[model samples]
Target: MKYSISWLLLLLFLPFAASAQTENPVYDEIAPFNEGLAAVRVGNQWGFINENAQMVIDFRDDLVWNQDADTSIPGVLGIRYPQFKNGRCMIQKLKVNNIPFYGFIDTSGEIVIQPEYLNITEFDQENAIGIYVREMYQGQNEIKLDIVEYIFTEVVVNINGEIVWPIMEREHALTAKRRYEVPKLRAKLIGKDLLEFKTEDNKWSVKKLNLNL
Candidate 1:
């Protein structure tokens, strides 16, 4: 019997493919793939693996968890592992006071944004708006810390973690003619490199954005 070239190639590669499948470490849980990678857990540590079953991100015990998760149900995972979106993932670091700081990592598991912002939104195309806060501390008790005065500004950041522009305040973004309010602190990219916004007169305005996305 004569076998086709494709069949012969498959026969030659079958053992290697089976070996690769068997080489994957036993994971406590594996989440569905998001953007070509999936979150895998061993004990309490979590990491990511690509479609090829190669561990791209090393397992770390410090990855954030879902504080309010109820894992009693079957097939439910408690930990809130980072998932890639638009080729970037959000990671959280806890401060000394247990406060959460947010940052972003590229697809290669390299830190693209340092965990410094008070809060940040997921990347919309090539830009994301984050809240930068300056707080005046009041005091801290056994339960929580008191922050009396918080001065925050919403700023726009590129994929390289550089602050390119400060988003206009909501009041300023509101149109005088129609009283149109900006929905939220978000930047939605249009086409290739355009940002659309509502002007003071309630007219649509489009500006060209040169970003490092």
Candidate 2:
């Protein structure tokens, strides 16, 4: 019997790989490790696991996907996949207005940003911005929500839920432009206080942030 170096390497690695596969014969799907954790799918729900093969995050509820608005839930996102970056990751939930919205979560599994937007950007250790449905209160202390009622606009917000810059829209720039120093674009912090955005003209716009973490 004979074997090539590659074959020998494969032989050496197979046991460990097989062991891992056998040990966690639970999850139906899994993702790459980020922040020392990996997202895994079991049944329809998803959760995270530690490097040492510990199921650190339990798969509780399934992340619902692209449905129409529910007109009930406060927030929702249709994303079923997520990866950790800069200690935070994006996730989605069930139908709100029967549709999904985007939000952020920390490595510790805390919902730092409520899933209130159809789009969102990853945080760069300090700030982020997203297009969200403006929350409204109506009579009877109820949350009034309808996509058509409010225009989608971008605004500067942090993990602490503080709005640094006022909201901005694409079509009506002059008003938002006057209220805010600059119009909000599809923007995220690429570096310290540095943001890169895609303008309505599809041009790249860079702005320096003047807010604190």
Candidate 3:
């Protein structure tokens, strides 16, 4: 009977012993874990740490900042910081004009894609929509007016940063879409290796990407 009681007590105390071995580092802010990694901020720089509290990614100041104001909005991009989705995390750099360009990094902190895309969605089913922007100025001689226009071209990109297809909204028309409300036109994975996009006719068109590569 004494042996059985001792075994029961050991089982109950095992949990407390294991919990005591966990590490607790002093961080300015600690975010919830995503993909087995958590974002930790020390001072103004941010880095990623594993579940064991080991810093897997070094701290950097150039990550895309999360706006605290957007946290209250529903369905809006209110992530406290960029997170790893599908073994990749988003990073940003400033262009010559101080515009922000985004790219991705692997869990090992390697830059898989250069920071050249104007905007990109997180990897969904090993595919994402990468948008490139071009600015144009149209001047009207008669009215003596000049207006700025932004042309946005979205492409279906794979996890390896390869453009599988340059999305065409209309048949035989290579014209890109406007920057107004770009999120609504992002490509979505509807099924296995199938991408669904809204066409210019307000109809949904499904395209199959070469996922084998």
* CA lDDT, candidate 1, residue 125: 72
**Across residues 88-198, which tens digit of lDDT does each residue of candidate 1 receive?**
777777652555666778877788888766556666677766655545677876688664544555667777887786655442321233453223433334544576655
- Give lDDT for model 1: 0.65
lDDT (Cα) of model 3:
0.70
Q: Which scores better on TM-score, 2 or 3?
A: 3
TM-score of 1: 0.55
Model 2 TM-score, all chains together? 0.61
Candidates in order: C-alpha RMSD to true structure: 11.6, 11.0, 10.0
Off by over 4 Å in 2: 1-23, 61-80, 137-148, 170-185, 200-202
Clashes of each: 0, 11, 0
Q: How well is each residue in 77-161 modelled by candidate 2, as lDDT tens digits?
A: 3233555657767776643334456677776778877776655555557566667656444444246543233456777767665
In candidate 2 the C-alpha lDDT for residue 96 amounts to 39
- Candidate 1 scores a C-alpha RMSD against the true structure in Å of 11.6
Number of clashing residue pairs, candidate 1:
0
lDDT of 3 by residue, 1-213 (tens): 999999999999999877776555678888889999998898878899998888999999866557573643211143467578888888888662465667889999999977766657677777777675545787665778766555667777777888777785322111333322214334566665787877777788888877667
